[model samples]
Target: MLMKSSKLLKLKFKHQLLMLFMALLTGTTMVSAQELTINGTVVDESGVPLAGANIVEKNTTHGAQTDFDGNFSLKTSSNAVLVVSYFVSFPKNQTTFKTKK
Candidate 1:
């Protein structure tokens, strides 16, 4: 009886540890999905910054306008996919970018 009790306690401890590990893994995965930023630059055909260009994520409200130097930063999640909309010197252009999971 004593031997069996010890074995049961060990099994329970192992199960608890396994549960803890799985919880940690799930948390990490979700956090990674949440913490993501999409960064890019908008330049003209002559390699100059195109200020005031609109960078938008399609089907969502997240958006950012290009800075004076054509730099833009937009925060997003793992499921976010950007659809940039802007007008350059030539015409209207649309671009797509995906956030890393």
Candidate 2:
């Protein structure tokens, strides 16, 4: 009777751990699904595409470099402020946009 009780206790503990792990996994997926992708093009004052421009999310490490056509895409949270930088010797530009569900 005592051996049976011990075995049952172990099984219950394992089941509880598995349930906890599954709950955490589901929560992570929900959070990641809320992330948004932003796309835009970088241009110079003369309206010419500026390839290799640096696009970074303000206050975060998320960033991307413009393609040959000055296009860039990055994933970030909603209402993020993006810093668009070009010309190593010049100042950076800031732009803000929000994400939709």
Best by TM-score: 2
Name the weakest run of 10 consecutive residues (lDDT summed) in model 1: 92-101
Against the reference, the lDDT scores of all candidates come to 0.77, 0.91
What is the total number of backbone clashes in candidate 2?
Answer: 0
TM-scores of all predicted structures: 0.54, 0.83
lDDT tens readout by residue for model 1, 1-101? 99999999999999999999999999998887675687789887789987888876667788899989889998865566565555644565666545533
lDDT of 2 at 87: 77
Clashing residue pairs in candidate 2, if any?
A: none
> After superposition on all CA atoms, what RMSD does each candidate show versus the true structure?
6.0, 1.8
